[model samples]
Target: MSSHSHDPHILCPHCDLLVTLPTLKYGQKANCPRCKSTLTMRWQEPRRRPVGYALSALFMLILANMFSFVNMNVKGLTSEITLIQIPKVLVADNYASMASLFMVVVQLIPAFCMLAIIMLCLPVRLPGRWNIRIAWILFHLKAWCMVEIFLAGVLVSFVKLIAYGEVGIGTSFIPYVLFCLLQVRAFQCTDRLWLWQQVSPAPAIHQPLKVGQSGLSQGLRSCECCMAILPVKQQVCSRCGSKGHARKKHSLQWTMALLVTSVMLYIPANLLPIMITQALGTKFTSTIMAGVVLLWGEGSYPIAMVIFIASIMVPSLKMLAIAWLCWDAKSSKKVDRERLHVVYEMVEFVGRWSMIDVFVIAVLSALVRMGQLMSIYPDIGALLFALVVILTMFAANTFDPRLIWDRSGTFENKEKFDDGQ
Candidate 1:
């Protein structure tokens, strides 16, 4: 083995002193010597954006919920549907179990989780009593926020759904697309790791005392720009060719725009039909809710239940949660942090599976093709429906759980200082 590898004490990046660490794990972190700065040589800290982005995301969410997704016309029957009616149809058709589960995972859970994050991150002082609860909510929301993954699933399902059904794209799809983008931006803005740092009190800064030159030294320095060891000869960073380094500053406007676009899209997305179907020369169109009714009427209770949960319950809950977060942030009211965290976790965990209904449609379309006499074709509604799912997923992804602790603004200042140092 190399001597460097065998040595128990590894040279500090900042100060040249060899320091021993506890057993090193994959994500283990250490501190710098000269400045006592926290360091993660092998691991990288999570990146996040500012609070404005979170608010914008809220707007996009609303747009996504309000639009039509799909429309269908066949023979003498024509119908239009919005995105909300899907799950109800599934549940009414005797698919209650799947519907209920889908509701919690895809819509209700994620919506609440997003709401918890917004509530926590708002620029208001949280009541000490509610801090614990808020922390818990943050923890849970982190796990439940799986909007991106859900979007991928929805897209794949849409491709297949169009194959067997007459599908039409709706107006809501534009906003839905925007919503996804905003969600990504929001996630970028808010980071859980950063939130943890804020919620947890900082450790006392200790200055090392001068000691004999016994292989340990204080006040050692390294190139801040390049992170290279120096022998007191170099003034500029050799690797990066920089004389100094500074912490990166985030662009508030860009992040804000992202959120704003997402919110704007939410409006039309909810208003439009998500799917349109024509069977046996009879044409039918259904929004998320109408689909549930149709399924219930047909005695497909199981399918109706699935649709109800995935399309209705989940999205509605998410809207409420986000609204609550916005309100809490503005009002600075104390919230149940732990509960909110749990809500967020549930949202992320279940968000992706909402595409199960879409998946079923895809499978059916792919396998059941009979040319003009019995062919399934996708319409604008499927596109819009797909957009709603994708946008919501993005919304979940964009929202950051750590905004809760940002009220004090100390974390931001500290980050700036660390970058400068």
Candidate 2:
């Protein structure tokens, strides 16, 4: 039984096991013994590494926006689209929502995240609790930074365009790719635990904690935003001022509601045309599956599979997985807790990739305009499909993975389960 204001002990966010963090050397990491979640890692020169990568990433992003991203040649008529023009073209086509999505996920979010990492890691003096506010926004927005996914979408779009004309990478293409890599590396180097610790030391634990047991049993919980371990009864985090629960309150109900709404949107997203092609006075509307089939039939096997997996298979299976997780969390039947935990992690990891199709549409619509000879325009279905992806992502976030380990017969303390802590 011991306590410290800056405690070395941590509660695993996934399984809630309390463990003492060891002094990790360079390139070493600590994992939770219970559910195999990576708790923390010690990177080589964490401060300098993230700051450098973020700075480079921001520079690359600037270059990406300044020049052409891709060029298409058809019958000696050429069209080139810049990275910044993607959203503007979508807006011109009257698809404001899809345009906003593209702008936010592809550019704004990644840029902000990189800047946040730089500010936090560097010795910058911000005025009046700005650090805490920035840190909060940084961690929350980190998951939504989809630059890498957008890059993948761009590659798929290029492959799809190979049949229509000679598709070539433009001046901005390599810079954007480098931007994606640098931003991801910068994010990986900036650890949430480390950042929160910089903002404020972790709150003290006044009670005894068992190393190999659940935090709930010890009346403790981890803040989702800052990873600060605190008493279960404390609703707001003392360190980061974030409101949290031992588990997400009514997590199942909220997740189920979002899942239901997303499922409804998914039906129309599949049925309606996502893209419109205008060529030689003929307009052709294509649904998601139709596009995939066209790509496959045209011998673009890899790109077709990528589209099918990202747009169709991933969303459908993710919804089913979320529903199954809710069931497992609620039911009293003996469930494989570890396997369920793995499934929840996978759902979180793959949920955002579903937006790749929406990005592909943006790229195609922006680059393939030839004034009625050949042009691509986004349809209503693209907006609906984007909404579906966002709704599912929110569903995944609202779901509390810790609940999967909270069922009866899993933990040693039966009273904790009965009390519903």
Q: How do all models score by TM-score?
A: 0.40, 0.95
Q: Which lDDT tens digits does candidate 2 get at residues 171-240?
A: 9999999999999899887877877887778887777777767888878899999998889999999988
lDDT of each: 0.46, 0.88
Model 2 clash pairs? none
Which digits, one per residue and each the tens of the lDDT, describe model 1 over residues 1-421?
Answer: 2322222233333223334433434344444333343444222332223344455555665766687755543343434444454455445544444345445654565556555556656645577635435645555455445445445544544443443455554665565566556655655445443343344322221333222111123333333322333333344443333343221123223333433554555455445554445456765555556657766776666656766787667765764564444344445666664456556556655655555555444323332334344433333444444445555555555444333322322111122212221
Q: Cα lDDT for residue 400, model 1? A: 42
- The TM-score between candidate 2 and the true structure equals 0.95
Look at candidate 2 and tell me the lDDT of residue 98. 83
Quality of model 2 by C-alpha lDDT: 0.88
